[model samples]
Target: MDATQHDADERFRGEVREWLEQNLTGRFAELRGRGGSGREHEDFEARLEWNRHMAAAGWTCVAWPVEHGGRGLSIAQQVIFHEEYARADAPARVNHLGEELLGPTLIAHGTAEQRARFLPPIVAVEELWCQGYSEPGAGSDLAAVSTRAQRVGDEWSITGQKVWTSLAQQADWCFVIARTEASSSRHRGLSYLLVPMDQPGVEVRPILQLTATSEFNEVFFDDARTDAALIVGGEGNGFKIAMATLGFERGVSTLAQQIAFRRELDAVIDSATRNGAIDDAVIRDRLVRARMTLEVIRQHALRTLGGEQGDGASVTKLLWSNWHRSLGELAMDVNGPASLLVGEEYALDDLQALFLFSRSDTIYGGSDEIQRNIIAERVLGLPREARP
Candidate 1:
């Protein structure tokens, strides 16, 4: 807040802009949907390539300390990095689970050996991880996680199922939450494990999103084995561990995502203008609304990160989720039937793809209703709604 801090923040922002301007050129601009960004998305190979590029550039896990293969960034520097990434229209880093979730948890709680063994490879993009939360029966009720892991002397035997695991099939590892001691209790009996996701006794059943191709899946554990040393935190601390990680997830996820949304908004405006659809007053009004929403989302994100906490601005996530859905709908409406087309036509011409992905943003992280409940109860001091 002092003059030195202000100067450092400005210098960091300027450095980030310079770095992106230097490295993010050529086809990457096309990748970020610059020629057009909302409907355009990278394929799996392009995504992995982008992650490697960012990782090598020391930009993958920008929040980590330098010794752990991060850039040793200040919070302001982190914001600057994201802003410049957005400004350059870079693709979202595909190693989000590694760079965001696993790395932070390791920083907070992992042992020296665990830190040394697990984090750097992730930072370097050698490893990819997925969240093994959200079981078939446990969606927002995270405490009801029934994936069981039993102690077998030196090793642990895991059995149960996790549904809606993002990138589960392709991930090298998973940060899994399971019920370890059921003394027949739910929340009090859980534990977290870092498991090799591709091992035997693991089944990955692809779950289709609205677009059709599977982006997530149900992962089953039939006597899946993991080492006892893989236990994250002490036993029965899984809920606490997972919740603590969600705080980091909410803010960081919003930062990365808001940038994406603003890009989408800009893309929408440009697409509308280019297509001659901006002549419609409805389209103009909608663009105006989108601009206002983007501003609010950005301000809310800053406030949430600035320490005014309440379920850590789950509302921000929920708002953007809904806002994006509307954006997709607007794109379709503005473009008429042509929005149904999906391809690599430069920028984000994959309107069909954006429309599809938008449908699920509300479901991931947490659903809109659940976020609203959290905001009401925790932020507004409201009473719970009883279900029949």
Candidate 2:
């Protein structure tokens, strides 16, 4: 970047750091380092309040356009902001699905009316959202989603199930991909509908995880209804819109995610030192390799930030997910035999929770197999995988 941009980013960094330092006090002091990944159940209500507090200060959605009530930070400034936020150990945000994924998709493809209705609440953190892309049969293969939504007079009635929905219990709305055409199959005749989560027809059943938290859920839409106009990108275009949302999913926030990963690594290193695990040649070598791979992940992410979307996102997902899963394994090794035991009430310490939760890292957010297939077929120009 140019010197002028560098100066501006530094200034933005200072601003973020200062604001977080000043405000993360009093009632919010306990929220630091709470709520993320396996620990989403930690101080959730307090974190929600903290999120709204940041929104009121214009810190949320820093990369969104100024017209959308965001600060309109440049990509460099956004990177600076996230890095500083992570440095401050701010609590995990409760609005990521809305701000990072749905808001941008709406800005890009939603009608003006939809933008006016949705964008403001997202910026204000007044509403929360969950994604309804994965179903029992269609986790990575999104085109296989069977959730059906049919037009009923002035509204659409959705009837089907969505599994692995994040934060559904707290979400106010769901951006769902449902089959709108009865005869449509695979990637055709689908519509991306914004359905309210509070209706009688919508059911959210929490799916307990290895972390002993229910951050993920199975949401049943038994004729759940949304306005006819709530469909994004128009009818029969859900696949494209959903793919765009997935592309946004892997953007600048990844830098902050890596920062969190680094914190976990540091903790593991500390544990090894205290427990004499650092004396083991195998453990020490693994730790060094973990640190090296993390830097590689960071560099790759920075390199591909504003580049092409699909294949680049796939490569990134593969890199970090594998790295993180490996880090979790190393954490267990560092903890030695104690890692096998749970605390009172089956409670797990952070490292134990990390080990268990990170097992799913390669499985969720498009599995490693799906990512490799995307890279092979799309990036390498290989023949497409034969579909059943």
Candidate 3:
């Protein structure tokens, strides 16, 4: 970039850093580094308040168009914002599913009325959202979803179960992909419906995890309803809209995620040094390799940030998920036998929690197997796998 652009980015970075430094004190001071991934239950109400605090200052949805209540930040500025947010060890955002995923989908595919109704609440942090894509039979094979929604007069009546829904219990709405045509199968005749979660027919049951937390949930919709006009991109267009949302899912925040991973890696190294595990030649080698792989992940992410969502995204997913899971394993080895035990009432230390939660890294956000299939068939132009 030119010197002018560099100076501009530096100025934006200063603004983000200064704001975070000032706002992350007083009542929010104790929230640094709290609530993320496997630990979403940590002071959730406090984190929600912090998220709203950022929104009121116009810090949320930095990359969205200015007409949509965002700053319309350039990609570089967005990167700077996320980096500074992570540097400050900011609490995990409470509305990422809304701000990062659904909000963009609405802007891309929703009717103007839908965007008018939803975008403001998301920008204001007055509403939270959860994805409703995966189901009992449709984890990675998303097109195999059996959840069904039927048009009834002015509304759509939805009935089905969604599994592995993150923060469903806390969400005010869900962007659901359900089969809207009874005779349809696979990718056809599906619709993306924005269903409110507080209605009588919806139930959210938290699924406890190995981390002793319920970051994930099973949501049952017994004739849960949404307005007929709430369908995004029209009926029978859910697959395209859902895929776009998934592409957004793998977008800009990944840079911040890698920074968090780096923090975890640093903590592991510190533990190894204090416990003398660093003396082990094997442990030292693994630590070096982990750092190198992280750099690879970061470079690949930057290269593909604004590019097409081809195999680049899948390749990045495979590289980072495997590397992260490996880092967790290395953390366990560094901790030695201590990793095998838990605290009173089964409390887990940081490394132990990392290892346990990282086990699912390769499985969620589309599994490693599914990502490899996308690369093999879509990128390599290989023969399609046989499907029954």
Among the numbered candidates, top lDDT falls to: 2
State the weakest 10-residue window (summed lDDT) of model 2. Answer: 303-312
Q: Give the Cα error of residue 208 in candidate 3, in Å.
A: 1.1
TM-score of 3: 0.98
TM-score for each model: 0.88, 0.98, 0.98
Model 1 residue runs over 4 Å out of place are 25-43, 274-277, 306-310, 337-349, 385-388
Residue by residue across 25-121, what tens digits does model 3's lDDT show?
A: 9989999999888989999999999999998899999889999999988888888888889989999999999999999889888899999999999
Tens digit of lDDT per residue, candidate 1, span 128-237? 88899998788877877888899998888999999988778778998999989957465798888989877888999987656555767899999998889998888889
Model 2 agreement with the true structure over 1-388: per-residue lDDT tens digits: 8899888888878888889999999999989999999788899999999999988888888899999988888778888899999989999999999999999999999999999999999998999999999999999999898999999999999999999899999999999999999999999999999999999999999998988899999999998899999999999999999989989999999999999999999999999999999999999999999999999999998888862276689999999999999999999989988999997899899899889999999988899999999999989999999998
**Each model's C-alpha lDDT?**
0.77, 0.93, 0.92
Model 2 TM: 0.98
Which runs in model 2 stand beyond 4 Å of their true positions? none
After superposition on all CA atoms, what RMSD does each candidate show versus the true structure? 3.4, 1.0, 1.0
